[model samples]
Structure formats: structure tokens, C-alpha cells
Target: MSRIEKFCAAFPDGDAERIEEMLHGYLWDSISVRDTAVRKNMKEKFYHGMVLGLLQSRSDWLVRSNAETGEGYSDILVYMPDKTGIVIELKYADDGNLQ
Candidate 1:
């Protein structure tokens, strides 16, 4: 199945583990030999654009970028037809330290 199919399967029930698994697949699959910046100094914007673009490819879910959530702006916001929402926050790690 495609990313959207996997994501749709994981969307309901609000299972964070499955959603994160989808994120992992996306993050890894997105890397390519043409994109060497990731190994050098890729910024968070790259991730944001790629993810946002992917989310926007499908019309079944509502997708937004830099969405305002009363408290602050989210990196990406996705809402299902049933009104379920997923807030995605992208983080960049430096010097191989994820913490």
C-alpha cells in the first residue's frame, strides 16, 4: 500500500505508535542520492515541505501548513473527514544527538 493508504489505516483510533511508524517510513523513504543536503546541513524546512506536499496530495484529508492552533502554529495539521486531527511537529537533530 502507498503512504496515504498506510496513514489512513493508522489514522483512526488515534494510535500514536502507528502514526509514528508512518512518519518513520516517510522520513526514510524521502531520502535520495540527489539530496545530499540531508547529510550535510538539511534544514527543517525541507522536511516540512516534503511532508506538507505529501499530505496535500490527497483530498480525503484536510491538510494545512503553519496552522494556528490557538496556542501556536503547528508545522503541519491534518484533519480527517470525521473531524479527527493530527498535529505534526518536525524537529532537527544536530551532531547526531537526537536528545
Candidate 2:
């Protein structure tokens, strides 16, 4: 089974709360270290690297960054055979208006 499949088997309903909790627990120190190093200039690449690092153990999933799609490029793409894929678009909050 794929990593996502195992996750779904455990959570069954895409549990955002549990996922967030797990990520926060795993990434808190890494993010803090990155924050201390970069201070005010934290970029999307940092977060992307952290995510990639965290998910590196999921060998069944194909993870890519800055992949070109048809019309544009995707920041991150997580693919699993015969299952749902994940596309992430990374954006810096200070660069554009999110409202």
C-alpha cells in the first residue's frame, strides 16, 4: 500500500487535525532552526524542503518540486498509483494580496 493509502486506512476520512498535529510535532524544531537562520526572509522553498524531508520515507509516493504542468508549473506534486494525487502551490504571503 502507498503511504497515502496507509494514512487513509488509519484515518479513513482525511483527518486534517491529526495530520496538522503530526506535521507540527515533526516540523516544529526544523522550522524553528530555519527561522533562526533566515529570520525575516523565510521562503516557500524552505517549507518545501521541510515537507520533502518529512515525506522522504514514503517510498511508494513520487514527490516532485517545481514540476511543469500544461499551462503552468506546480510547486509540489505527490503522486500515488491508482489513488489521489496532491498538488501544492507555494506562495509568499507578503508578495501578493491573499484577500
**Considering every candidate listed, which one attains the maximal TM-score?**
1
Off by over 4 Å in 1: 11-42
Poorest 10 consecutive residues by lDDT, candidate 1 = 33-42
Tens-digit lDDT track of model 1 for 1-99: 886767656655667688778866877877875654665446677877876876676688888899889989998888888888888888777674768
User: lDDT score of model 2?
Assistant: 0.62
Residues forming the 10-long window of minimal summed lDDT in candidate 2: 4-13
CA-only RMSD, every prediction: 3.3, 4.8
Model 2 Cα shift for residue 61 (angstroms): 0.8
User: How much lDDT does candidate 1 score?
Assistant: 0.75
Tens-digit lDDT track of model 2 for 1-96: 754344433322456566556555656544566363564456666766766665555677687888999999997787776586877665555545
TM-score of model 2 (CA atoms): 0.62
**Model 1, residue 23: what's the lDDT?**
68
